[model samples]
Target: MAKGSNCSRWVLCSLVKLVFNDAYISTKIHHRQVSPLRRPPTAAIAGRARVPGFGTRVNRVCVRAVISEGDKKKTMVETSKELNESAVESGGWVDVRAVITIRKKMKENLNEKIEDQWEYVVNGMGQGICLQLISDQIDPVTKSGKSIESYVRGWMPKPLSHPHIVAYMANFKVPHDFGCPGAILITNFHGKEFYLTEIVVHGFKEGPIFFPANSWIHSRKDNPESRIIFKNKAYIPSQTPPGIKDLRREDLLSIRGNGKGERKMHDRIYDYAPYNDLGNPDKGEDLARPVLSGEEMPYPRRCRTGRPPTKSEPFSESRIEKPHPVYVPRDETFEEIKQNTFSAGRLKALLHNLIPSIASALSSSDISFKCFSEIDKLYNDGVVLKDEEQNIIDNQFLGNLMRRVLTAGQQLLKYEIPAIIKSDRFVWLRDNEFARQTLAGGQPKQELHLHRMSVEEAIENKRLFILDYHDMLLPFMERMNSLPGRKAYASRTVFVCTRTDYPYAADGLLIWSAIKELVESYVEHFYPEPGLVTSDLELQAWWNEVKNKGHYDKRNEPWWPKLDTKEDLCGILTTMIWIASGQHAAINFGQYPFGGYVPNRPTLMRKLIPHEDEPEYEKFIHNPQRFFLSSLPTQLQATKVMAVQDTLSTHSPDEEYLGQVHHLQSHCNSDHQVQIMFKKFSSKLEEIEKTINARNKDIRLRNRSGAGIPPYELLLPLSGPGVTGRGIPNSVSI
Candidate 1:
């Protein structure tokens, strides 16, 4: 090792002369990169840059660092060897190898970090054009597209000219009521068309194949655009009515807007009038924008996506850009796809345009939401308000904490339930299929309804409610889950209502019952007699304080139970303990497992489902996966969300849980009854944990216990620190 150090010193001096010319060293030691493959004279001329009029295939670079500490020489190496040998013998400065190894490891780590950062930068540049393949059958086109054609089911996967990149997207279920009484919703590519971008079959047949078709996944024979006319239960291939009829007057009115571009005609203010002077608005002749004649005004008829999906009516919201004939960037291969790599100059140019908006979004000092928030706000606003009219009553309105929302499934509006009613509401709302939907899907099992009671009885028993969003979301489930980034159960979450139903519910019930028993045991031991609860001023004061002060708003409510008996005391304590401990554990801790993988719970919905009337429909039929990817979260958004969810779901190192309440034991050690209750409570918690484990192994409860479902361990009584995802904390620790 000592010899190697001396050897490095010997080689260093000679290499400097051999590597760089006298012109590079004598002129100036410039800190710059030059491609090793480029001409030598080019570097000398530009000083630190490549000269113009040169081959720009810039690949590798040469870097140089000058050691200016008295320089390196052959005699110096001999002196360095002598110093090292003398130091090693005396052991004054020890372990030369240790220093070398540490430095080498540091360099390796630095290189690794540098490589990772470089990859991030490179991938970020290609985010718009690049995607990876996931899950292909290898069994080619069979049962998709224009169902009138017979499906043979034995078509083999054939190799195309270029390797097909399958951009895997989140697959979602659409109900029978969606998309023209069910067109392609039940089949492959059961997604609505997005008009933003086109799905292209690049290098298709090495040339244009007369009729466009999805040769990879669907059909090679049929023209995808030409519908079957859907007569008997299928119209326009599968349509109830053409997606929202025309709004032409409003389209022209937008060009001559009331604000600044007001056009006056025939002693009246005509919002849709096209004046002759269509240039300057200051000339008093209101001119229409986009510099077009009256005939060129687009969107004369109502278009499917004339406005965003969030807007229930065609022109319900204030929007001017009625993209009449939506342009589809389909079929033509992107520049990077054609060339197979993005150029440095082109990337720099793109960053030049995007960096400002990206920086603004990330920067705390000047955060901006103009890019995506407006569209998102509209989607969220569709719940109880539309067209500036508030739909929810004042009493029902629970003022928003996070700027808004509904509490669950207490109310239902006509616009919110498109899956049920085509237009107007006729059927009186009922819970006839509610129990069935929550259990074995739409199938009504006779056993499930064995204990069916009146709504009044169910409500009084406190088993009427659900974890929620089932009824609220059934209408938009297809469109909501179809989004590329976000996956939520506004439509499908209703069935998972009770504690005995699903993973969180079934396992959570074990913890709840254990705590309830603990509470009842504690109340019985403390109170002893019914009069003891009345005479105990301390207990009375505590109950009074809780009702009159803690929950002052609900102080006068009829629901408040009279604490005259031990049973009343037991119920209140059990509820308080369950809410703080088991209930919160079921909902809070499993955030990462449910959401960390962006596809499962994508944070953003980049695109909307495309309708059949758009040009994008032509492209979607060719490559469904491309549209799927675009409709969800992009690569960057998923990464960011994963990190946040992971942090949020993590447990603290010094964490406390339901069974491990040692602090309470320390204070209650003097009282034997308190000590006895704690022991029984801890024992009960352990037993509950075993029961949960047994239930997880059970195959009957398919939502959680089945092989496909992740075991419901979020309420599994015990866990260690750091994002365990499963643990019954004693309180809402998060």
Candidate 2:
């Protein structure tokens, strides 16, 4: 029965091996069967253990032929396959599958954690590097990959590498209701590395730590490649207040220092202590006394440490001091005081210098009245005129003085005279003299006559003196006209002569004649015109007849018109020459004298004495009456005849005709009227057309050999239309 049961077990295992394929387990089970530990010792144990109720051990012995090793090996492989199948049925592979799944999940989780941690590390490393760069420290390595290590090393306190300090930096939560963390690191743009102590972030004693990543690094050198540097130390919290709690996990993580070499933490401890305690007593006292004196002082020892102690001590009575009064010396003696006043020479000099200043000061209307009063006093006191250099105070002096004062004042004080005061106020003061001259009542008759006579006599005397003086100065005048700049003063004399008109007297005529003679003589010498006959044609003809009769320019006969009329002759000759010298020549009739009607007048009656050798005159001698008769035609032409003389009639004289002639003469002489005439004549196209038409007619008539008046002669009648029938002859030939 035991042998049968064993055979059954082997068959079941073989069936199981056919169902599951597990080569590795099957190989392991085959090796175990071949070992001695799996030998039939189990057979001896089976026989010996059979006692009492034990079942009988089954043993089977069969004679077997000798088999080859290869067959033996094949049987062993098959048996091992059966054992492996048995192992699979018992579920031994489940544990191995579970272990592989768990391992894969763990690997994925670890990779994610590494990635997250690397990001934080990179950010922190970048911030630390930037802080070092801003502080202008040389980075240890040129490669960007070493930037994190370099920066961490740079920020450390004295005796501690920057990396060591970074490693030891801590962060904690504040005790207050504020939700911020305890500590922070501040890197400033000015290359300042600051450890911000007692920071009240979120209203808490222990504040959050902030490692700034985005702050710009400002460079110290101007070049682009120069490293940026901070101006101050980095800011980090010194210590946390006692009793702070409820810190965050992240805060704690941020505080953890990266493990580096030896930590020299004493530097941080010293930084937290009061500055006065950091140094020796003598050094501290020397630095502190100046700040406590309340006078201007240097910075105290504590000020170097970020927080300066407050200067809030109250002053005590012991610190007060007493005051003293001041005393001034006084002067005596009236004479001494008077000496202090300006002396005459000094006053003169002061007045001379201050004239301009005073004028400028007075230019302001507000001060002008006072200045005027002062100036009047000075003038009354003879200060302005009594000085020997009074002539120096001419118009130029006053003008320059006023200008300088005004300019100086304007530059110095920016004070200027108002425009109105500068223009009109001074003009009134200088021009209004009537108030001083006018009296309370009319003058006495005798006094008035005396005054009138005195004025008249003064004028007449002055006129006579000027005439005599001009006569004596005539040679100088002739010399002046010949010179250039040398004649400037003489030019002034000429101006006075021309501007001072004395009508109805020979003075104006005499001066005018002299000037005209001088101008004509100069013209004739420089630009002469020979064979120029300047007298009226009638007078010339009469003179010619007398000369032919041997009555003039002959030894037998005397010349007519005496030397007294020499000036008149000169004037007539000068006027004729002046007029005839131009292309468009016309005499101004009013400017010349008339003749014939008043033949016996003193001006015309004067005669020249006869020369020794003579010839008897016959034509004018036989007809002395006829000599005056020849002038009748001229008289008739110049006179206004009454048309009613042939019958008995009463009418007004031809005043209108005479007036019109006067008006025409006046208009012809006026520069304004001549300008108006020329402007109108030039501007009017119709008038130019009429003139051209008339000229064309004249040209055509002349071309056709026809007798016709010239256009110019025809137009001459239109020139004095209103005075055509006046006493002046219409046919008065030029």
Candidate 3:
């Protein structure tokens, strides 16, 4: 037989035997006398003697002793019961029988209380290798009963025998009702510590607790799977002291052991944990136990965060001696590119060029664009320009459109971000909380609902910026566009003001303020430019000067749908969406060729700072935004390599407010806006399909219908390549 086949056979046999051992133990317990269980101490004093079977069988023997004691009581209780019955028949009260019965009942209650204190450790970790302290034990220091906190503090890890072996301790708190064993699980392991002698607990009233020599086992540091497999069997310290016969911890090639020799192993209820839990050792304990705070420990970043840096952004700070150049040759000459991409004059001439996709998307907000297209078609075919009857008919059409749009707006405002993003998923699970809440009165409405601030408290508590963008801004823009088109447009010069919900609900002034803030933030992060708007007064003054200069009129002139009234705040929203959604999407596709959210943009603010309340927060779950910002600079560099430097540097921070609007209008018309949007959307779907196909090359997962890439991994940027019709040639600079 092949070596691999033999290995597989061995593993299968071991698994079978382990399963059988668990079943046998469970069945044996039922026949054996039940009694109180005593849990072991978390640690023993360092450098203590390793007595064979002492640490291993102490708890087991304690239960046996309790059972023996219970049997003695049961025998006395039976004799007392007979005496009590005779006394009752003779009509005489027997105090001896009553007292013995009471004592027996009291003894049973004591054993039950002890049993509760030491529950079996049930976890998904292949087997429970450790005992759990379910209840408070006598504090070694104070001599009074105390919680796990006090006990954990008293037992400190001993210094490693070797200089290279670095040891650290971690505590796992099992959550209540999670089917976990209640305990403060501690594992003292070392890195590069092949010859770790033993781990001893410090401070105790009784003698020190000692583990087996070479018990400080460390798995392969590089292998993630090895670290994940729990240390299931904590072998008992052999009666004989450490010598040539004993194997070193490093001798065990695998975490589950090599299954080599017929080693004597003890299997208990806690040993064969059914749940296969990770991180937590106990299910029925409080999970949110505060991380034990102490002097800053020299732990590695990956261990703490649980997220290693990607290839583009390595965690180490080692600087390259000769950095790779970002610039690459492109087809277009620098001067040619300068005119087409940089000057911003030509691009700014057409509004459709700037925001075709956005304008097309907004069409769904109203029926006027479609109706007007038909209306214009009829007029062109040979209708008179000015007809009273035609005007009245148009007014009626406008009124009905307004009524429906308003109703749709009302319906759109109450939907949450999750409901919007995963609406299909919600509908499928009819019993989902969001679905139940939304479809309460009738069948679900198809119109997109805007999220109400009152109902957004749950998302607010998470404090994620992307979630806020989804829950508030996206829906608001959809609803706002649904308003009556022309009259709403005519109500221009509405006093502009700043509001928290800028770009979505706030007037032009607020949206402009938001745009300014975004530029200022970019400048702050990248250019180190001072004197960017630092105060509200400065921003307002800047806005006033720009508005008075007729810059707005110049920017809006290129818009093709010249309906004469200037209420179109599309400039502000278009810019906002470009910054919020478009840039990240483009960057992600440039890197991973995927169509999901990109994280780690170097230019964006990081949201993964330690939470104020959780001083010792362990980030096992990485903040998506952190990755989004960290990777942004690399995306910009990639864009530079693609010869798109003009996109980065053309719009000076000073000109951003007016420049974006002017540039967008320069290249687009109303009809082209709808066409451009369709092209872009179609392109995005194609990219998504390509991404799916690329990953599904694995034959094992290909045939499974629902086995596409995981939703989290499928995360793509909101934008992609070819989004803009204009060729953004490649460069290699940032």
> What are the clash counts of all predictions, listed in order?
20, 43, 71
Please list the C-alpha lDDT of all candidates, in the order they appear. 0.34, 0.22, 0.23
Top candidate (TM-score): 1
lDDT of 2 by residue, 1-734 (tens): 00001111111112111111111111001110111011111111111111111121112111111111233224334423432233221221100000000000112367554643442353233322112111111223421111110111112222111111112121121112223222122222222222211111111222112221111222222112112211111211111221111111122222122222222211110111112323222333333322222123212211112222333321210111134211100100111112232232233333333433433433442121122333233223322222323334445547577456534533222111211122233321221111111111111122122233354565565531221244445557656545532221111110011112222122223323332544344323312223222222322332232222212123233534421223433453344222322111112221111111122111111112212343323534655444333322221111111111101111112111101222111211112332343234223323433443454354343321123211222112123321111122111111
Evaluated at residue 594, the lDDT of candidate 2 is 12
> 260-357 in candidate 3: lDDT tens per residue?
22211111111100111111212223422222221322111110111222233233211212353211111111322233444443333221121222
Alpha-carbon runs more than 4 Å astray in model 2? 1-721, 724-734
RMSD of each: 34.3, 59.5, 32.9
lDDT assessment of candidate 1: 0.34
TM-score for candidate 1, residues paired by index: 0.36
Clash count for candidate 2 is 43
Candidate 1 local lDDT, 308-383, one digit each (tens): 2112222222233344322111211122222222232233223222322343344443222233332223123322
- Give the local distance difference test score of model 3: 0.23
Model 3, residue 70: displacement in angstroms?
A: 38
The worst-scoring run of ten residues by lDDT in candidate 3 lies at 96-105
Per-residue lDDT of 387 in model 1: 22
